[model samples]
Target: MGVGLYLHFPFCQQKCNYCDFNSYAGMEHLLPKYLSAIKQELFLYKVHVSVVNSIYIGGGTPSLLAINDITTLFDSIRRNFYVADRAEVTMEVNPGSCTLEKLKVIKMNGVNRLSIGLQSFNNESLKKLGRIHTVEDFIRTYQYARQAGFDNINVDVIYGLPWQTGEEWQDTLAGVVELDPAHISLYSLTIEEGTPFGRELKAGKIKKIDEDLEAEMYENAVKLLKANGYEHYEISNFAKPGKRCLHNQIYWRNEEYVGIGAGATSYMGRVRYTNVKEIPLYIEKVFGNDYATAEKEALKLDKIIGETIMLNLRLLDGFRMDDLTKRFKTNIDQLYGPTIKVLSNQGLLKEEAGMLKLTDHGLMIANQVFQRFV
Candidate 1:
C-alpha cells in the first residue's frame, strides 16, 4: 500500500484556547523561509516519495498561506514526489482565513478537498472558544467553496464546551445541516494539560461539562447528523455516504504514512519518527546541518499489535481476525481472549461475521474497552 503524506503548517492567526498542536500564533514573515526548508526536506527524501496516494496539508491554519505560496508548494511536491493523478489532496482552513479568490486558486492548484474549521456556530460559544470567525463567516466560506468548484468538503464541530447549553448544541447542528457539507467531524472537547483551557481548569476558573451532559450532547449530535444523512463511520467523524475521509481511513486501517514539517509524525514499516518541534531546528536538520529529531521509536510486535487494535477498533467495521493473526503471528483468540470475553459479557462489544465491533453501549464506554487491550 502507498504511504499517505501529511504536511503540517504550524502557523495560525490566533491559537485557540484548547489547542495544543505545535502551531504558533504568529510567524507569517517566516513563511518564505519555511517553504524553502520544506522543499529542501522534500528534496532530501525525493527518492522515497513515489508511493504517496494522499497528501493532507493540516495546520495551525494552512489556509493562511497566500494562493501563490500554495501553488509554489504544490509545484515543489510535484517536482519532488510522484502523486497519483486522483490522489486525495486536502487542505485545512479556518473560516476566518479564506477568501473566494484564494479558494479558487487553491482548487486550480489541485487541492480537491477542504476541511474547514467551524468549531461552533453560536456567537457566544465562538467567543468562549476564542474562534476568530462568526457563524456568518462560516456561511460565506461555505458559499464561496461551492462557487469555487469544490465538491468535497469537511466541516469540523466540537461538542462538550464549557457552559454550552443544550439548545446551543442543537442550534449548531441545525446550522451545519443547513450548510450540508459533504463531511462532518464532531469531536468532544478535551483539555490537554498544557493548553490555556487546561490552565484555567487547574486554576478552577473553568469547568468541564458534566459527563452525563456531554454524553447527551454527543447523542444529540449523532441523531441530528444521521437524520441529515451523515454516516457515523468513526467515533468523532461522520460523512455523507461515500464521502468519508480517505486519508484518515488510512490511519484507522493502520496503514503507513509519512509526516513532514515540525512536530509531524511518520509511521512506516516498523519505524516511527517525528520532526523537531522548533522551526529553526527542523530547517537546520533538513539542511544536513544538525541531527535534532524530537523523537524516534522503533516498535516491537506486541506494541504494533496493540497499536493496530487501538486504531482499527475506532472504525465501525472493527478488527479483522485474519489480519490480526497475520500481523501479530499469534491466534487472535489466544492473545486477547480474556479481554474480549469480559467486554462481550458486559455487552460493550460483540463478534459478528468474524469481526469485533462495539455495541452502542460499548461505543459510549469505549475507553474502558480499549484499555483492556493494554
Candidate 2:
C-alpha cells in the first residue's frame, strides 16, 4: 500500500478552553513562510510514487487559510508527488470560521472530506468550552457541507465537560445523528496543563467530575451511536458502515506517512521523525535544508512489532497473526507470549476466526492491556 500524507495548519481563530494542541490564536502572518517551509520539507521525503492513496490536512483550522493559500498548497502537492484521483483529501474546519464560500472553494480544490469541530450542541457547553461557534453555527455548517456535495464528513464531539448532564449528552448525540454524518469522533474531556481549562481547574473554579461519571458518559456514547447505525470501528471513532478515517487507520496499522508543519510527526520505513515545534525555527531550518527535525529513532524489529501490536489492538477487528508473522518474522506468541496468555485467560483478548480480538472488557481496559506489550 502507498503511504499516507498529513499536513498540519497550526492556526486557529481562537483557542478553545480544553485544547492543548500545538496551535496558535493569532499567527496568520506566518502562514506563507510556513507553507513554503512545508513544501520544502515535502520535497525532502520524495518517494518514487507519484501519488499516495490518502492525504489528510488537519489543523488548528485549515479552513482559516485564504483561497489562494489553499490553492497554492494543493498545487504544491500535485506537483511534488502522485496523488490518487480518489485520494481521501480531508480538511478540518471550525464551524465559526468556515463560511459557505470557503467550503465551496475547499470542495472545488479537490478536498473530498470535511472534519468539522463541533464539540457540543448545547450553547452553555459551548460557552464553557470557550468555543466560538454556537449550536446554530454548527447546524448551518453541516447544511452547507451537504449542499456542497460532501458525503464523507466527520464531526468531532467531546463529552465529560464541566456540568454536562447525561440528558444533555443524549441530546448532543441525537443532534449528531440527525445530521447523519459519515463519521463521528467521540472524545472524553481531558484537562491538559497550560490550557484555560487546566488553569481554571487548578484554581478550583472549574471542577472535574468523578471518573465513574466519565466512564458512564463513554458507555452512553457507544449505546447512542450504535442505536443510530454507526459502527464502533475504533474506541473513539464511529462510522456509517465503511466510513472509517483512512489516514488514522494508517497510523493504527503502523504504516508510513509524511507530516508537514510545526510539531508534526512522521513514521517512514522504520525511522520516526518529528519536526521542530517552534514555527520560526521550522521556517529557518527548511529554508536552509537544515530543517531542524527534533528527533529521529531507528526502531528495532522486535520493538517495531511490539509497537504494531499495541496500535493494531485499538481496532475492533484486532490483529492478524499471519500479517504479524510476515512483518516481524516472529509470531505474536513468541514476543508477547506471557502477555497474550494472561490477557486471554482473563477474557480480555482471544483468538477468534484466526485473529486476535478484544473482548468488551478489553476495550474498556485497553490501555492496561497495551502497557503489558510495551
- Write model 2 residue lDDT over 1-374, tens digit each, in one string: 57889988888888989999988888888888998988887887665344688999988888888888888888888888888877889999888787788888889989999999899989999998989899999999999998888999999999988798888988998999998999999989999999989999999998997778888889989998999899998889999997889889999999888888888998877989898887888889889986558888899887888888889988898878788888766776777878888999999998888779889999888889888777
Specify the highest-TM-score model's number. 2
Candidate 1 per-residue lDDT over residues 1-374, each given as its tens digit: 57798888998888889998899887777788788888877776676657679999998899999878989999988888888887899999888789999999999989999999998889888888888899999999989999999989999999899888888889888998898899999888999899989999999999999999999999988888899899999988999998989899888877888888888888877778888998777777777744335788998767677677867888977877688898667877776777778889999988889888888999898888788876
Candidate 2, residue 342: the lDDT equals 93
How does residue 347 of candidate 2 score in lDDT?
90
Query: Against the true structure, whose lDDT is highest?
Result: 2
User: Candidate 1 vs. truth: CA RMSD?
Assistant: 1.5
Q: Each candidate: what lDDT?
A: 0.86, 0.87
